[model samples]
Target: MDKHGNSYDKALDVFEKLLDEPLQKVLSGPLPLARAVGLATTSGYRAAAIAESEGLLSRSTEGDYLRGPSTRTIGLSALGFGEFALVAEPVLIQLRQATRLTAFLAVAGNSQCMIGPHSRGRGLTFAVPQAQYYLPSLPVLDDERLAEISLSNRHEAVAAQRAAIAAVSEREDRQCIVGVLLPGLHEAATDDLRAHLRKASDLLRTQSEKLT
Candidate 1:
């Protein structure tokens, strides 16, 4: 038995092995035997009780177990992105998970902008103070190097002017302008990033049209 009352090593091993299998397969197939062996060897029951307390798992009315809805929601939102469908909170969580990095959702505020909410990856900590000031300018990147330059000098007046031009040039259906800042990136990666952002924006537009 280990600190969490389960054979920590065994539980981790089982968890890692089962990860490649679908949850339904693990729940309905012989994987439970592995779990049982792990449990018997350690404090599996105690660990399960603790997990239940933490809302990580739950028993169903039919006596089957399943992950909680919160977990499912996060999973679904990870690869899904649409502006209209993007609830700030869940999408932010999904972004952090998918990118394995910190992320933010900023919106225009009173003569400035604000980072509404953000999420950080597992074991990562972000120390940006709350209500950090955001400039009311957007960035346009004609190339990857420009993107890097815009982000590195986000507060500079010239960079802000360039961003504003880029945002306007890239605008489609609506005039909603926003800039994305990525850290430690090089110019070579700009093409892929631009393609992804364009797709994301399109998805958001589609969702918005459906709503109205």
Candidate 2:
């Protein structure tokens, strides 16, 4: 590849790292561009300048970096998952209304869950600091458990949180975890939460299939 080609490839890598980093930290404050892009200061700054010129990144007042407006536009654009969000938003709203709890959709990893679109409930609520979390209660990911609903609980700051998660296939190579966040863990409330989650998951799965 030519020199220009090399620069282009490095710029692409920077964008990938920008997306891969925890969104909460990205939004919270400035991040070290050199370390984030895995390049030396001079090279990383050069790559960042290229990305900034195209609106893929923005520099903080303190000279750190974060995702720019263009990134959100692309994320919600058709090229991303905007269509799925359109179909899922109504279901999420309904789930929130029915259960009076926060209803959310996330991309689940082995032990972490990346929070996505969500409907917040009234009163005291539990939300992720950075919209991504490592919930110890979340079931481990496995081929056999990919499409099954899992229920679990974890305590945070004296309040017990209960979650009902249903992992379903989103695409041939992707899957999503649809879930609800409740304030407390109560045996009496588990049944209702499970029922609502099951219904919502079914709607999401059915709607997701049509998109593919």
Q: Which lDDT tens digits does candidate 1 get at residues 105-203?
A: 443323344333355445432323233344444433455212322322335554321111112112232233223334333323245445444443344
Record all residue pairs in model 2 with backbone atoms less than 3 Å apart, i.e. clashing: none
Go through the candidates in order and give each one's C-alpha lDDT.
0.40, 0.60
Report the lDDT tens digits of candidate 2 across residue range 34-145.
5755677777667667777777777668655656556644654522344456566688889888877788877654444556667777666534423656554445444423
Off by over 4 Å in 2: 1-83, 124-130, 135-161, 170-175, 185-189
By TM-score, the best candidate is 2
Best by lDDT: 2
Residue 185 of model 1: what lDDT? 37
Task: Report the poorest 10 consecutive residues by lDDT, candidate 1.
Answer: 161-170
In model 1, state the lDDT of residue 96: 50
Question: What are the TM-scores, per candidate, against the unseen true structure?
Answer: 0.36, 0.50
